[model samples]
Target: MFKSLLISALFVLSSQVIAATATNIAESAEQVSPLLPGLAVPNIELKDQYGKTVSLAERFKEKTTVLIVYRGGWCPYCSKQLANVQKIEKELADLGAQIIAVSPDSPEKLAESKITSPNYQLLSDDSLLLAQKLGLAFYLDDKTAKIYRNKLGVNFVSLEGEVKVALPVPAVFVIDTNGLVNFQYANPNYKVRLTEDLLLAAVKSVSEQ
Candidate 1:
């Protein structure tokens, strides 16, 4: 009887340890990706350069959408990426893909950041509603925020004149007509970007499928 009881107690202790480890693993895995491919993306509302409200889902219905989320126009990296995207705009359109660039910039700042093409829609996410829904928004450190406002002259403020609280992770998502994410590129490093060649390849794959 004593031996049997010891075995039973050991088994119970092992089971408890296993359960605790499993719970820890699950909690650790909760650091979700900002955007996951093969999932339906957030259908958040945004405004165009002209301040006209637009629905992301509505755009998906018309064609395959290449969604580019960037920092504000003040970032040279973002500006270069925008220009590169414009160069590939026609080719993507031929494949029934449209590029929409969304930034945390206000509509007024968006106007200043125009890429000189009506085909590429520059949308504003000043409220960060879309970013938060996608799990991509992160708050900057107080020191960095102060530098952006003071030295950089970027003044990361929303249209409502509230100081900027959060910024989206620079990312690109290729959405299918069904509003599902087909491909995505997200980088925590601000200087890096998804190459146009890779973007074209993703679009081609979607088009063929």
Candidate 2:
């Protein structure tokens, strides 16, 4: 009977701690300005996998931009989503849209990632500035962050000694040449992703307009 009570008490304590941490993360996330339809997308400069500087506005100046924001390559779900996007690359191109995938990975890590699409641009958002501007950036709870660094080998710090592990919610945005967002999909659940069919429909609808 005593052992049972001790286990129950421990479980209750653990649950409370988890709840509090989740609440804090959610509260901090509330400050992010979520991108909505018709909002002008922010123009952010990012480094491509090839170590070249790229401007988001200039690269897709005349074409519809299909922007995909993901966590770094260390995330299996993110890698799978990116690969799925590549599988539909031709369809996206046929709709006159260019796909760009952004993540907090460094340029070196971005290049190492095998997720590739023809004419696809992989931009490094190591500073997470773009994610912050879009109101998609969120801080991982302390325990989760520690696990990522210690177990997952995802050190979200730069050589300059800046820690930047806070990440964007995996998101997708279809933006017209006018810099206005036409479609956006963002979920707090990192495991879920926008479907290819939905993305195609959105691109077609916006390109027609």
Candidate 3:
């Protein structure tokens, strides 16, 4: 009986702690304007996997920009997100929108990402300058960093591999033609993502605005 009681108590306490952490993360997320409106998308040049220098900000012209930042092609969650985004491409285009995915992976990896699901364009943020400017990026913890290096074979060093670049929290944004983000979703955990319905709603709202 005592052992059972102890186990129950521990479970309750762990549940409370997890809930508290989630609440705190959510509250902090709301408080921090890592994303701001009215500010134009960061003007940075990134090369596509095909080695063409592409200006990110320039791509937003004449349409709403749906910017999706993912950790890498290695993440299955990112793959699902891309698949969902692709599913809504026609609708998004009808709403005068385009989707661009930016990541800290190499051009080769971006190519692989395209091969996996070829709908939207992918940009290589190998230098991570754009992520730094956007403030949605973070480096992996030591444990995960090692996992990425050894197990995942994600060679950030080989790409532009000098200083460690933080991975971009998977984020989705609906930016209007004016370059203002009308809606945004971000989370550190890769499993979670913005639903297509929510994103479509955002696009519709932005279009109306």
* Per-model TM values vs. the true structure: 0.78, 0.80, 0.76
**Tens digit of per-residue lDDT, candidate 1, span 20-58:** 433100111124257688989778889987889999999
- Model 2, 105-155: lDDT tens per residue? 889988887756656888998877788777788766677878877876553
What lDDT is reached at residue 147 by model 2?
82
With a 3 Å backbone cut-off (N, CA, C), the pairs that clash in candidate 3 are 138-166, 157-161
Q: What is the lDDT of every predicted structure here? A: 0.77, 0.80, 0.71
TM-score of 2: 0.80
Task: Give the total clashing residue pairs for model 2.
Answer: 1
Which is the leading candidate under TM-score? Answer: 2
Higher-lDDT candidate among 2 and 3? 2
The better-scoring model by TM-score among 2 and 3 is: 2
Model 3 misplaced stretches (Cα beyond 4 Å): 1-33, 114-119, 155-165
User: Which parts of model 1 are misplaced by more than 4 Å?
Assistant: 1-32, 151-164
List the pairs of residues colliding in candidate 1: none
